[model samples]
Target: MLAWLLQRQRPVPIIQMLCGPSGEKILGQLRVNSHLREHLRTIYAAPCGVDVTWIQEYLDGLRIPLLTEAQSEELEGEVSLDDLMEALGRMVSRKAPGPDGLPVEFYRAYPTVILPQLVQCTERCNTVAKSICEEGQLTCHAAHGASAIYRHALRRLLHTRKRARLDPDGSADNVLNLK
Candidate 1:
């Protein structure tokens, strides 16, 4: 009850997904990044993900510290940013909205190329596709295109890069330079 009350004071920051019951409203507010927003909206329209109730039930037996440790182990090694970009590219393209703001059937239309890309990091959807390619692992384009997952990944990457003093010009060896 205390947790619930605390949560009530600050709602979960929901990503405005496409294709749920509130799709129209979500779409309408997505004008700044129209193309990207449309795609996200459609992702929700498709029925996906595991059941929340079942997931919570499973969590009951797990201890919080153990879960955190397991998560830490899971991300033991670092994968390339390009891989992440590729994954997101395919995800957004297939799951993203079309010009009409409707969901584009990524799997059905472009199955061969998109499947492998889904598991890798993606960077094709946003303004950073070309740069991510040229900059090798780090690029402003990649940073800009990074989805929520990438943001989390970038945070860690930036912290580590800072500690290493990788870039003298504050560009982190040109890995994350917008200018």
Candidate 2:
């Protein structure tokens, strides 16, 4: 089966790919970088005419409470190896690989080897994040911004007693019940 799978195949002619005029035009356009840049800019640019005052206000409110000395210290606390391991265990093995082409399975399969390095990396990231927060430089309000900014430092310390399967009330208690 492996031998059959590894068998080499004949390459298709380039002329076949550019058989049509539209295909030729597309091939020509692919050589230019402007289209790629324009596409990315269009996709990533902030929405025009939208009032971002509310977002700024919300962030400002969050910063005032979090910037307290005690809170900042808590945020800068050492990462727990147990919690990191638990989170790693929860990761789905079949999930997509990151940019380095390493899937969650790679870490899960060799926790002893990878966990230490990962813990160090996560600690460094936390330190940088804390510094950024302290410097008041975390200003991005993109739709898919960093999760560190969204998760409150206080909330991390709270231990969820039970994982409630369902809650109809949608109260603060119910929200806190979530993992």
- Tens digits of lDDT, candidate 1, 100-162: 453446444664675346435433333354456566866654544454344444344333433
lDDT of each: 0.46, 0.51
**In candidate 2, which residue pairs clash?**
none
Name the regions of candidate 1 deviating beyond 4 angstroms: 1-67, 75-104, 122-148, 151-179
For model 2, where is the 10-residue window of minimal lDDT? 158-167
Q: Per-residue lDDT for 1-179 in model 2, tens only?
A: 76666665544434322323244433444443444556569878957887999999898778331233443344434556665576666666777434567888887888888768756765666666656666777743321134343233323333322112122343333333433
Candidate 2 Cα deviation (angstroms), residue 3: 26
lDDT of 1 at 108: 44
Top candidate, metric lDDT: 2
**What is the Å distance of residue 171 in model 2 from its true position?**
6.3
